[model samples]
Target: MKILKTIAFVGLFVAGTASFAQNADEIARKVHDLPDGKTSSFTAVITLIDKSGKTRAREIASYAMEEGTTDKSVLVFKTPKDVAGVSYLSFEYPDKADGTAVDSDSWLYLPAMKKVRRVSGSNKDDDFQGTDFTYDDLGKRSLAKDSVKVLGEESVNGVACWILEYMAKDAKAKVSKRVYWIGKDNYVTYKGEFYDRKNNLQKELVCEDISQISGYWTTKKMTMTNVQTKHKTVYEIKDVVYDKDVDPKFFTVSALERELVK
Candidate 1:
């Protein structure tokens, strides 16, 4: 939900680590701690691409901010009349100190139903809207929930990266394990892989067009592809700003109905 985390970009999520003396827990923590600015706003052109390459695009205006240890974000569809006024709001909290996970609260607004549907933690495995991103992918999962291991090094786009394999401690987790290729150069997330409980590769997230904006490293473009379904969603970001003053109303459920962000 904050992903939009990282715009999925806002934090669709980053962190620093030292070369020597790094363990799986420490590395996972650093990766989990990756910097998403205090506040951010941007317009993302989301395109759904099928294996045949036919595409459909939708415009979404997204706003996100960090308040204390909590992160809040809102996304409203702007174009494609049918989906317009379709919005989402969420509150993501930091992990508990005891290493327990704190579930995120998210709600979806539909114009036809004229009611807001609350998205529960159980739906974390569900697709986000119709995109390849699952509800869980957009929120921050606690580090304590996973047993992460460093799978050694590899290169993505020629940049050295740490291959990390994260296996959920819970045997019944919808997603069995995830592999992340995190950049060693700046610790930027270059790519990610998601698998199901059956241990089959499910989806992949690849980030590109990374740049430093307003002194923060940001990923401007990303694609989430479903390996099994062969369907993909591409996010193209524009007008991105960090640490800007965001209206408090945007974070509320009322904003979802009011359509106040535009």
Candidate 2:
């Protein structure tokens, strides 16, 4: 009877754990599906701080649109004569195809080069314009790419949160694992920790100053810190509008070059 009782208890524990993991995946999906409008545009001020505490700032105009299950975005640098006219574009797909997971298609336009170039898939881990954020970090990440488990519940800045751990499905992923503290009320990720290939903590991300814009919750300020290098980057949204009709051509490479000429 004692052995039977012990086995029953173990079975119940396993069932509970499985249920919790399912709930965590559901929560992550909700977070990923947060309702941004069909079209959105914003201006952002990005500040990059190096290990020595020296800071450089850039201004950018960003536009995004939802096309079916894919999201496309374009960022155009507006200020600083040197980097002005530089732009990046990305198109994120929702699922794997042809028996392989699909990464976003990304492109960069340099004023000096006078041409637009495609950013290769292997370079997704590279820093974006010397900032802490990588090219992959800028695009929408599909939950299907990772296996999620609920770590537990926690609080971030006094707000209740669900702690989740995500392990990459691919061995060659830049980030082997990531932990997220997602707000219970808003379904927004308030804090995240990224682990490198060796499972070493490499970076931390914090999102704050959330506000409702056009009936959608939006993060107004975000900071990414490189743990090993002590380098940091802060992005602050200045002006934002939603559901505004942005020119479809603006997302094309030809349009990127034309904008550079202006």
Candidate 3:
């Protein structure tokens, strides 16, 4: 009878774990599917600080729109004469029909080259325009790309959050694992940590200045720090608008080239 009882307890524990994992996945989907508007635009100031405390800043205008199961965005550099007219475009897709992970596509247009070059998958881990953020960081990652688990609860910036852990499904992924602290009230991510293939902490990101804009919760300021190098980048959004009319062609590679000539 004791052996049978032990076996029953083991079964109960396994069932409970499976239920918890399902709940975690549901929460992750909610976080991923948070509604922004159909279209949005904003200007941001990106400041980079190096380990030696040296700093550089740039201004950029960003536009994004939702198209079916995909989200697209374009970035145009506005200031700093030398870098002006440069643009970056990205398209992020939802999970494949078979529920497999797929990386987003990104391209860069340089006025000097006058050509739009595709950003390859191998370069997704590289920094974006000298900023601490990687190309992957700029795009929305599908939940299908990772296996998620709830890591309990925590408080971030005085806001209650549900801590979640994620492990990449691909062995070649830039980040092996990630942890996110998502706000319980707004479902916004408050903080995140990234680990490299070697299982060492690579970067940390913190989101602040949360506000409701056009009925959607947004993070007005974000900072990402490369823990190993002690370099950081801070981005502040301004002049944000949602559901604004945007030219359909603006998201194309041809538009990226045309905008530089303007």
Top candidate, metric TM-score: 2
lDDT of all predictions = 0.85, 0.88, 0.89
Q: List model 1 lDDT by residue over 1-262, tens digit each.
A: 6534454342221222333225667767777787879999999999999999999999999999998888999888898998988998989988777868888889999987788889987787888878888877776777767888777789998889988888988888888899999887677789999999999999999999998999878889999999999999998899999998999889988887766767
Which model scores highest in lDDT? 3
Off by over 4 Å in 1: 1-22
- Candidate 2: clashing pairs of residues: none
The per-prediction CA RMSD against the true structure, in angstroms, equals: 10.7, 2.1, 2.3
Q: Against the hidden reference, what TM-scores do the models get?
A: 0.88, 0.92, 0.91
Candidates sorted on TM-score, descending: 2, 3, 1
lDDT of 3 by residue, 119-154 (tens): 987888778999988888787777887899988889
Q: What is the lDDT of residue 34 in candidate 1?
A: 78
Model 2 residue 243 lDDT score: 96
Task: Report the C-alpha lDDT of model 2 over 120-229, residue by residue, as the tens digit.
Answer: 97788788998888887887676777899999999998989999999988899888998999999989889999999999999999999987887889999999999999
Query: After aligning candidate 3 to the native by TM-score, how far in Å is the CA of 122 from where it should be?
Result: 2.8
